[model samples]
Target: MSSEVWFTVLVLLVGVERLAELVVSKRNAAWSFERGGVETGLGHFPAMVVLHTGLLVGALAEVWLLRPEPPSVLAWSMLALVVASQALRWWCIATLGPRWNTRVIVVPGLAPVAAGPYRWLSHPNYVAVVVEGVALPLVGGAWFTAIVFTLLNAALLRVRIRVENQALAGLAA
Candidate 1:
C-alpha cells in the first residue's frame, strides 16, 4: 500500500480514537456533573463535533480527489508533529484524569491542575489540537483541508479557551 492509503487509514484510526475518547469523556462528564459540576460553552459543542468530523472527511476527500504531492521532508515532519500531538493530548488527559471531559464541566471547590504540560502552558491540549489539525491533513497532502481546519479551529479555540478559563476561573489561583 502507498503512503496515501496509510494516511487514510491513520485518519480513520483517529476517528475511532475520538469515538473512544467520547466514551471516556462521557463517563468523566457524568462523574463531574454528579459532583455538582457546572458546564459552560454548551453552544459551541456541536460546532466542535462538526468541525472535528469534517477534519477527517476533508482530509480523506483531499487525498482521494486532489492527490497533492507530499514532499518527503514535509511529510515526515508533519507526521512527527502528529505523533507528538497525540502524546501531548494523552498527557493532558492523564494529568487531568477524571476532571478531563470533552465538555467544560467544572467541579467547583476543586483545584485546577498545574502540573505537567499545564505547568508550561495555559492550554496545552489546544496546542496538540492545533498541531494535529494542521499536521494530519498535510500528512496526506491535504493542504486545503489543513488550511481550512486551522482557520476554523483557531476561531473555535478563541471561544473555547475563554469559556474554559471562565469555567475554571480562580481554581488555579
Candidate 2:
C-alpha cells in the first residue's frame, strides 16, 4: 500500500482509539458523580479538547504539506514508540479503574493510587502522552507538529497538574 493509504489507516485507527477513550472516560465520570466525587477541572476541559484536536489536524497537515521523507529506520522507531505509549496509557487506565475519569474527580480518604505505572512516575499517563505526542507526528515526518504539540501539552499539563493536585489535597486532608 502507498504511504498515503497507510497514513489514512493510522489516522482512522487513532480516531477510533480516542473514541473508545471518550466512552470509557464518560462512563467513569458518571460513576464518580454517583459517588459524590467533586470535579475541579471543568474550566480547562474545553482548552484540552481544542489542543488535542489541533494535534490531529496539525499532524495531518504536516504529513501532506511539508512531506519530509524520513529514513525508514526513524519511521519504524517512532511507530514502535507510539505503540508502546498506548500500552502504557492503557495500563494507567486499567490500574486506576473507575477513578480514571478524564475529569479530575477526587473521592476523599482513598489513598492516592500508587499501582502500575504510577509506582514510578507520579504521572505516568503524562509520560505516555508526552511520548505519543511526539511519536505520532514524527511517524509521518511531522516534526513541527510534534514540537508544537509537545510545547502546548507541557503548558497545559502545568495548569492541569496544579488543579488536580489541589483537588487531591482536599481529599488527602
Candidate 3:
C-alpha cells in the first residue's frame, strides 16, 4: 500500500478509537455526576475537539496537498512513537477508570490517582496527546499538520491543566 493509503487507514482507526472514547467518556461523566462531580475546563472543551479533529483533517490535507516525500526511517520512527503514545493513552484511561471522562470533572472526597502512568506525571494523557499530535502527522510526512497541531495543542493544554488543577482543589476542600 502507498504511504497515503496507510495514513488513511491509521487516521480512520484513530477516528474509531475516538468514538469509543466518547462512549466511555459519556458513561464516566454520568457516573461522576451521580457522585456530585463538578467539571472545570468547559470553555476549552470545544476548542480541544476542534483542534483534535483538525489533526486528522490537517494530516490528510498535508499528505494529499503537500505530497511530501516519504523517508522510510523518519516515517517509521514516528509511526512507532504514535503506537507507543496510544498504548500510554490507554493506560491512562484504564488507570483512571470510572473517573476517566474527557471532561475535567473531579469527584469530591477522592484523592488524585497515584497509580500507573499517573504515578510519575500528573497529566500523562496530555503527554500522550502531545506526542501523538506531532507523531501521527509526521508518520505520514505531514510536517505542517504536526507543527501546527503541536503549537495549538500546547496552548490548549496550558489552560486545560490549570482548569483541572482548580477542579481538583475543589475536591480537596
Candidate 4:
C-alpha cells in the first residue's frame, strides 16, 4: 500500500481510538459529577476538541493536497513516535481511571492521584498529547499542522493548567 493509503488507515484507527476515549471520558465525567465534583477548565474543552479535529483534517489535507514526500527514515521514525505516544496516553488514562475525565473535575477528599505516569510528571497525558501532536503530522509530512497545533496547544495548556491547579487547591482546602 502507498504511504498515503497507510496514512489514511492510521487516521481512521486514531479516530476510532479517540471515539472510545470519549465514551470512557463521558462515563467518568458522569461518575464525578454524581459525587458533587466541580469541573474547572471548561474554557479549554472546546478549543481542545477543535484542535484535535484539526489535527485529523490537517494531516489528511497535507497528504492528499501537498503530497510532500518525507524521507522514509523520518517518516518511519515519526510513525514509531506516534505509536509510542498512544501507549503513553492510554497509560495515563488507565492510571487515572474514573478520575481521568477530559474535564478537570476534582473529587473532594480523594487525594490527588499519584499513581503510574502521575508519579513523575504531574500531567503525563499532556506530554502524550504534545508528542502525538507533532509526531502524527510529521508521519504524513504535515509540518504546518504540527507546528500550528503545538503552538496553539501550548497556549491553551497554560490556562488549563492554572484552572486545574485551582480546582485541586479547592479540593485540598
| Per-model TM-score on C-alpha atoms | 0.96, 0.95, 0.97, 0.96
* Better structure of 1 and 2 per TM-score: 1
Best by lDDT: 1
Q: Write the per-residue lDDT of candidate 2 for residues 68-139, one digit (tens) a residue.
A: 887888889999998999999899999999999777888766778888988898888888888989998888
List runs of model 2 lying over 4 Å from the truth.
Answer: none
Q: Would you list the clashing residue pairs of candidate 4?
A: none
Candidate closest to the true structure, highest TM-score: 3
Please write out the lDDT profile of model 1 over residues 102-169, one tens digit for every residue: 99999888998899899999999999999999999998899999999999999999999999998889
List the candidate numbers ranked by TM-score, top first: 3, 1, 4, 2
| lDDT comparing candidate 4 with the true structure | 0.89
Model 3 C-alpha lDDT per residue in residues 1-173, reported as the tens digit of each score: 87788899999898899999999999999999999888878899999999999999999989988889768998999989999998998999999999998899988899888899989998999999999999999988998899999999999999999999888777667
Give the per-residue Cα lDDT of candidate 1 at 85: 95
Tens digit of per-residue lDDT, candidate 4, span 33-113? 898888878778899899899999899888889888989998999999999999999999999899897788888878887
Checking candidate 1 for backbone clashes, the offending pairs are: none
Residue 99 of model 3, lDDT score:
98
Residue pairs with colliding backbones in model 2 are none
lDDT per prediction? 0.92, 0.86, 0.91, 0.89
